[model samples]
Target: MKDMIPVDRKMSTMQDSKISARGVQVYYGETHAIKDVSVEIADNTVTAFIGPSGCGKSTFLRCINRMNDTIDTARVMGDILIDGEDIYDPRVDPVQLRAKVGMVFQKPNPFPKSIYDNVAYGPKIHGLARNKADLDEIVEKSLRKAALWEEAKDRLDKPGTGLSGGQQQRLCIARAIATAPEVLLMDEPCSALDPIATAQVEELIDELRQSYSVVIVTHSMQQAARVSQKTAFFHLGNLVEYDDTDKIFTNPQDPRTESYISGRIG
Candidate 1:
């Protein structure tokens, strides 16, 4: 059985965080999607957010990169700091912010352009490379980091959409990393992939944490256990519990977390 403990008690037990959220909330028109949630994402580690359908896990993830701003009715409040700087400040340009904090969605959305073009897009837009050779170097480096270079090195001119679902996802990851983002947000990245593809992506995610902070919203408890160093359990717009992944899976501190993880309730 899981213990019943206060949320603060659980958080106090973790190490320092790289990105911190305090009293964060989100609303879509009249619907309160997220309510007063606070948590920390450690640097160079993978953190997983798990919950049932409509539980605000994805909503909270979008807040980190300011993706919610694209929604007409979406509204976010409270503090979300990356490296101790409040991202919600009026001075923050979401365009520039998104460059520093990249996101990958549930589907493997690759552009219609060639694979090389896909990886070079961010660097081209951000002016990270000066000449053609520099841009090619950046693309090659990004693909190598994403582990897609061997498969894609010869097919650089092939359309990104021509790849398999799993390959496309990896390509998207390469595209995100091409910008050298400090943080990476993934929302159900494997939900659309097959078992083998899922495994490959999961392995890649683990490798990614050595250089970038990763936050993932996943529906599979086993996936979370396999990938994340930390886990946050959300229920009904509230963050019920957050702790080491091992503890959350083996011995959750909240009844709600226990119930959800134990298949008793969502």
Candidate 2:
């Protein structure tokens, strides 16, 4: 069973939300990919989206960082606000928005570059550093945050892709953190990793929430229950339920949520 937080603490978290969505709908060509879905994600917290395949959990996850904009036929409507600023506003630059909201994909797709360069790439393009020393410090700090500095320190000049699956994932995580993002979006970040690697990444996720709002899409109910404070269940493009992870797991309000959590559906 999952542990529950105090109701007062939950209320405080609600007031401290960092990302707010309202009436959000998404489409790819004529097919609707996401129904009207809305939720508030609190800063310094871990939120997980869980559901069966093709349920639009991943689709909704991408909306937070606007990754769907890269798809030619994709269309997103409704407001997605980060810190009260609407991201879809004409004034917002998608490129800059991406930097503030970094993403880590399921596969450990590190740049074909060296480990150090992989972490340094973001700070370089974003000009987060002024000189070589600044870039070096950023790289070290990011790698440390990802819990990979000790293992990867000596091999900084080696190719990132040459690392083990878990190491590569951690490197990707370090790369994301190097940008100093306010929110971190992870899409099945541990799906490609082994048990040990998944555990390592899960720990990293917990640590990351201490700094940034983390939103993750995962197929594993155990993973979601283990790492997330808040959980949302999606089914057939609809947000069926969202609540404290404990409530969603132990005593869901919606029948669909209860069904999914009890292994009756999904």
Candidate topping TM-score: 2
With candidate 2 superimposed using the best TM-score fit, by how many Å does residue 238's alpha carbon deviate from the native? Answer: 0.5
Worst 10 residues of 1 by lDDT: 4-13
TM-score per prediction, in order, is 0.94, 0.95
Error of 1 at 66 (Å): 0.4
Candidate 1 deviates by what RMSD?
A: 4.6
What lDDT score is found at residue 93 in candidate 1? 96
- Compared with the true structure, all predictions reach lDDT values of 0.91, 0.92
- Evaluate residue 62 in candidate 2 and report its C-alpha lDDT on the 0 to 100 scale: 90
